[model samples]
Target: MRIGMMVDSYKPYISGITNYVEINKQFLEKAGHDVFVFTFGDLDYKDDETNVIRSPGLPLADSGFYLSMRYSRQAKKILQTMDIVHVHHPFLSGRLALRYCRPAGIPIVFTNHSRYDLYAQAYLPMMPEEVTLGMLQAYMPPFCKAMDLVIAPSAGMGRVLRELKVENEIEIIPNGVDLASFQNASPTPREKYGYKSDDILIVYAGRIALEKNIPFLINAFTGIAGAVPNAKLLIIGGGVQQYEEEIRDYVAGKDGAKRIRMTGRIPYDELPAHLSMCDIFATASVTEVHPLSVIEAMGAGLPVMGIESVGVGDTVQDGVTGYLATNDAPSFTAKLTRLCLDSELRKRMGRAAREASKVYSIERATQRMLEQYERLLREPGRRKDKLYFRLREILQRSLR
Candidate 1:
């Protein structure tokens, strides 16, 4: 089947969503399906068999939302030739797909990877909580209801959709990891980082943003170091400029401040080695749908500790694969301390985590997504063309 996968961002700008698309595209193409990516920004990638379309009118920062007009034109032309148009996010690309593909009678499948309400709350902190929640309540239901099929990466996210009164059929499909690439890689020697072989390395890999709750991780590590002297925290990835200073100051205030290492943004290829070197991985973010960092840590056989936030429950099994803490500094500190103090527990949990991660392999995820696409294509009332324009006009009127 010919498929057009639309996303707001793609490679070179790494995130969970971009990684999901790239991994799934590889598996889909390998399975003999013709796949194309319609996204923003210039991708430094080449695939002779797969097509990648770069849409226009993308803004400097919020390029994803800014592409509605350009994507409308680009999507109409490209989606016309495809059997299914799969949208990664339910914003501009999704709107474009619905507007163009629906009229042409092509089925559109949407994946809700991020919790829009939580995301809006983080990015637009100046907005009142009531206003953000109100906007989400108003916006989510109809957008979900309009899609041919809606897929949520975690059951928690699926529940959120149901609560929003989204009448459309919703499926839970967790994001996939490249198990082969992440598993059991030899650690890059720690001599470069001035780590002794006996040092317990804790890694936090993801965008260092306010929403990620990095400060909590730093605080938790401070508590951990009070007990375990050789413990070190590796802060990976990058974000706003101020976060660096925030992290620096936090670490400096601690007695073992020099143990904290910030690698800025490591290249993707080196991630496995970095993961391999770590004894434990942790994240405090409550906003993730299916955090790729946690999955990658699992793939590397590292014991993970994080908040028992909605979708995250599916990945981290308390006292089994990894510890799941409540959303508090004490809870996170206790979990981190447990993992750091118990080597045997870490090893056991790491083994379980590796086994659990296999379930989210790229092949399985791609097959599930393909099944959803095929099912949607065969359903009745699947309009091919002109429905999007009509729907857009209706939605615009309602919003105003």
Candidate 2:
């Protein structure tokens, strides 16, 4: 089988979507299937893997995303040869697949990995919430219905789509984690990062973007640091330089400034070692669709305390593998303090977390995705190429 993964952006961007596409490509190839990445970006950017087809697009500053309406001539030609095309980003890549592959009888699977409504609120705060939600309601249903299959990374996200009036049948498939690299990772020595061996390190590993709510994490940590003097927060990701600088400034203004450390973007392969050095993993972000970082941290044998919503709520076993608390500083700080102060509880939960994380291993996830692909191929009326296009035209005319 030849699989094409379409994304708005790719490597050097360091996002969960990028990681997902990369891992899937590797695992699928190992299973004797050819995988290709179809994306828009700098044509000069070096890809670490083979069969990555890039089309030129207008660069959107340093945000690592490109704005392109259609694929290059070569990309369009190669993408048509694929048996299946999995789209990660809905708007850009989704439309491109609808235009090209749908006519060729290639099944397109779209995974809803983002909470676009929340994202719109975060990025375009000036936009009214009503308008944002209304736009989503108008857009998502038709686009999702057009695809051969729609995938939601977690049950929580599936519910979000249903609420948005996306009446299509949705499949719940959790994102996969490469557990081997994290399971027995060697931690970076405490002395190297200027931390004492006794320090109870709490780590948050992801993009330092607005949607992540880094300031909220800092606020929660402030309440915990006073209670547990040895507690530390290690932010192990990077983002727009301005946002990183803003987070740094906020941390500097806090009382226990020395307790906070920010390591701007580590290599994807070296992530485990950083995770291994932490005692607890914590995140306050409510905009996750199956957080791969939390799974990776759990695979590294670290207990987690995340906001009780969506992906984090689904992944964590609450008081068993970790604690899931309300999205408040006092509630989250209590859990953070509890995990940091009690070594035995951390150990027990860490063990459970490691065990629970096994279910999301890359191999298992790849197999599940492959099963879906095979099912789609064998099912009668699987290739609704003409039907979908005809319906789209009708829907568009009716809407207008």
Candidate 3:
């Protein structure tokens, strides 16, 4: 089948969505399916991967996002030819699929990968929460209903959609991680980064933005510092310039600031080695829609320490893979401190985490996604999507 991935941005902008699309495309191609990526702007940017169809759009600062209402003629032509299109971002890419692909009788599948409600609270603090939620309630349901199928990366995310009044059926599918790279990864020498073998390293690998709650993790580490002198927090990944600077300044002035090291934006492939070098993976963010980083960390054989919510709560089988604490510094720190102090417990949990992570491997996820795609294609008339198009056509004809 010819598959097209629609996103707001691509390459040079490393995001979970970008990684997911790239990996899924590679695997699909290997399985003898034609895969292509349709994105906006970044036309001048050279992509290392082939079959990336770029549409011209205005760049939205250094956030690595593009804003545009339409695709280039060439991109539209290519997109219309796809057997099916999977949309990652709902606002831009999702609407575009409805505009361009729907008329062509192409099935559009959308994946709800972001917690837009929490995102609005993080990015647009001035906007009232009720207003943001109301906007989502109005937008998401209709958008999801218009699609042939909607996918939620986790059950919690599925529940969120239902809360938004999205009556459309949501398929629960976990995000896939390339586990082969991490399965037997040799740990990076700790001395290279000025750490000893006995030093307890807790890693958090993802964007250091407002939604990620990086300061919370930093502050929680401070509470554990007095008890575990060798405990170190290694934060990997960079974010928006202003936010990154704010996190850096805050960490710099802390009492035990030296204990936390922020490695700004490492390469995607290098993450496995970094995970191997760490004893535990930690994240304070409660805004995840099935965090791929957490799964990747588990694949690298590190126990996770995360808040008991949505993606993190579902991924970590508390007491088995790692401990899930409430979203508070005291509770999170207490659990983190225990993992740091007890090496035996960490090893046992780490082993279990590795085994549990296999369920989210790229091969498994891709197969499930493929099955969904094939099933959607085999459905007669794709009634939900066709009904939408037929109504649209009727309305257009009536106006004429």
Candidate 4:
């Protein structure tokens, strides 16, 4: 089958969505299927992968998103030849998929990846929450209904879409993780980072942005610092320039700042070894849509410590795989202290976490996704794609 991945951005702009498309594209190609990625701008940027189709667009600052209403003629010409197209971002890429592909009688699939409602609260604080929700309620349902299929990475995210009044059927598919490297990961020596073997290392990995509640996690760690002197924190990610600077400044002035290590942004491939060095994986963010970082940490044999919210709540089994605390610093701190003081509990939960993470492995996820794709194809009315490609082949031969 010929598959096309539609997104607002790609390459040099690394996010969970880009990673998803890139990895899945590789897997599908390995399975002997033709795959292409259709994206906006970055036309001047060189890609290290094949079949990454770029079209012109205006860059949206350094946020890694491009803005344009229509794709280039060449992109539109090739897009209509695909058997199916999957859209990641709902706003730009989603609408474009509908505009370009729907008229061509191509099937479209959309995945809700982030908590956009919470995102508005984080990025546009001056905007009223009710207004943002109202806009989403008006926009989401119809946008989703127009697609052939809608997917949510977690059941919690499915609920979020329903709350937005999208009554359409939502397929719950967890984001795929390349778990092979993580499963066999060897721990990097803590001594290399200036930590003793006895010290309890707690790590947070992902974008260090406002929505992630990085300051809340740091404050909670400071509280634990006095109670459990052996507990240390490792933050392993970076985000927007202003937000990253704000977090760095905040951590710099804190009383127990030295105990917390911030390793800006590291390559995704190195994450498993860094996570293997930690005892617990922690996140304070309430705005998560099936956090890949937490799942990846679990794959590295580390238990998670997260707040009781949608994506985090859905993934972590409180008191089983890891502890889930109310979205408050005091509550999160108490659990952190408990996990820190008790080495045996950490080991037990870590084991359970690793076992649970197996379900989200890339092999299983890609197979499930492919099943959905094949199901879409089996439906009638998609024969136009075949005829279009056949005629194109004939025309090329005639010109030759």
Candidate 5:
């Protein structure tokens, strides 16, 4: 199949969606499909295997978060050559694909990555909640209903769509990780970071924004330090300078200030080694649709501790693969302390986490996604309600 995968951003700008596209593209191509990425930004992938076409007229300000594109006549020419169009996000790229693909009798599948309602509320704080919901209600439903299939990373997001009365086919297909990358990487030495072999290392990787609830993790780590003086917190990833300063000040004022390390924006290649070095990985955010960091950490054979929210809960089986805490300082501290003090428990959960991560491998994810595309292609007139049933069958087979 010649697949046209559309996303707002790619390459130099790394995020969950970008990583999802890159990994799946590799798998899809390896499975003998011709895949072309339709995106913005300067992509750095090799030209032989995956073809990337840059779209024009993207607004400079909308580069990072939102995508703004002026649908070019060339896009119609591009759509004409593809067998299927897979949209990664429901923004400008997806909207344009929907506009063109429908009239051409091409099958288009949309994957909802981030929770737009939550994102709009955060970015557009001045707008009233009713106004925001009203705008979304007017804008999203038509785009969503027009698609042949709508894929969500979690059931929580699917629920959001259902609430909006989006009368289209909805499927829950969680984002996957590169299992081999994490499993094959060498572990980093704890002593290199001025920590003894026995010291407990807790790591957090992702955006350090306020909405990520970094303050809760900071306070919880502070409490954990009072109990385990040798505990170290390694914060990976970057954020705004002001927020980073606040975190620095808070860590400095704590009793075990020297033990806290902030390494901003580590490259993807180094993540596995860093994750392997840590005894436990944690995140306190409840807003994630499907967190790639949590999955990556588990793939690296580290037990995770996170809030018992929708997506996190589905991934972490409490006492099995990892522990889930209430979204509070004390609850987070208790879970962190539990894994920190018990090496045996950590090893057990870490192994379980690695095994559980196999279910979300990029290979399996791509294969199942391809099957969905094939089914949609074969039976284009299948009722929208039947799409969910077909998706469930695919998921069940993939799980096996």
Candidate 6:
């Protein structure tokens, strides 16, 4: 099967969506399928992976996203040849899939991987909530209805779609994790990070942004730091320059500044080992669809403490895998205090977390995804090539 993964952007710029496309492509190709990534911008970026097709687009500031109304002529030509196309973003890539592939009867699948509503609230704060929500309500239902298959990475996100009035059937599939790496990882020595062997390390790993609720997380830690003498907070990952700077200044102004450490962005290959060095993984972000960082932290055998909202609420097993408290700092701090005090509890929950993370392994996730693809293809009503305009039939093509 030739599968096309359509996205608005791809690396040289790193993001959860880019990582998802890259990992899934490898798994599908390994399973004897030809997988191609169809994306915009980064046209001159050299990729170590094969079959990534890029079309030119106007770069949108430094957000790592590109704006384009349509795929390049060559991209459209190759995209229609796909047996099935999976779209990761709903706006740009989603519309293009319908325009280029729908006419050819190539089934298109869409996965909702972002908390776009919250993102709008974060980035476009000047806009009224009613208007943004109204826009979503008007656009989502029709666009989702147009797809052959629609996926939601978490049940919470599925509920969000329903709230947007999208009545289409939604499938829940987690983005897979490379579990073996974290499951068997060796910790980067604690001393190297200026921590004693017995010190308890709390971690928050993901882009530092307003939507992540970083200020509340920092304040929560500050409130409890005095109580937990041996505990330290480690923040990993980088994000919007302005927001990150704000986070730095906020942290600096807080008490017990030395207890908190921020290591901008680290190499992906080094993530597992670094994560393994921590005692707990914590996040305050409510804008996650399904957090790959949370799952990766689970793979490293760490208990988690997160807010009781959407994606984080769905992933953590509450008191069993870790605690889930209300979104406020006081509530979050009370739970963080408990985790810091109970070493035995952390160890027990960490075991359960590791076991729970197995289902999201790349191997199992790929197989589940492949099953969905195969089932869609086998449907008697599916149109594989009946409406397709074969490249061979278009002799006058630019042949670029």
What C-alpha lDDT do the candidate models reach, one value each? Answer: 0.81, 0.91, 0.91, 0.90, 0.80, 0.89
Please provide, for model 4 over 1-400, each residue's C-alpha lDDT reduced to its tens digit, 9 standing for 90 to 100.
9899998888878777787788888888999999999998878888888888888889877777889988888898888788899998999889889888887678899999999999999999999999999999999999998999999999999999999999999999988998888889888889889999999999998877788899999999999999899889999987777778888899999998999999988887788898999999999999999888889899998989999999999999999999999988889999988999889999999999999999998889999999999999888767756577558767986999
Worst 10 residues of 4 by lDDT: 381-390
TM-score of each: 0.90, 0.94, 0.95, 0.95, 0.87, 0.96
Candidate 3 ranges with C-alpha deviation above 4 Å: 381-400
lDDT of 6 by residue, 104-151 (tens): 777889999998889999989999999999999999999999998989
lDDT of 1 by residue, 1-400 (tens): 8888888777566788877787788888889988898876553455433578876655565322334355545545766778888888777787777777776778778888887788788889999988988887788789877877888888888888787677787888988888888996888799979999999999999887778888888888888887999899998887656766687677788777788888987887799999999899988899988888899999999999989887677779999999999999898898889899999999999999999999898878877887888777677655424356456656886999
lDDT (Cα, tens digit) per residue for candidate 2, span 43-74: 99888789999999999988989999989998
TM-score pick, better of 1 and 5: 1
Q: Which residue pairs collide in model 4, if any?
A: none
Return whichever of 2 and 6 wins on TM-score. Answer: 6
How high is the lDDT of residue 155 in model 4?
Answer: 95
For residues 140-176, write the lDDT of model 5, one tens digit per residue. 7898888888998888778888776677878988887
Q: Highest lDDT: which candidate?
A: 3
Clashes counted in candidate 5 amount to 0
Score residue 314 of candidate 4 by CA lDDT: 97
**RMSD to native for every prediction?**
5.3, 5.1, 4.0, 2.2, 7.9, 1.9
Clashes of each: 9, 0, 0, 0, 0, 0
> What value of lDDT does candidate 4 attain over all alpha carbons?
0.90
Model 6's TM-score against the true structure = 0.96
- Candidate 3 positional error at 395, Å: 25
Q: Which pairs clash inside model 5?
A: none
TM-score of 1: 0.90
Count of backbone collisions within predicted model 2 = 0
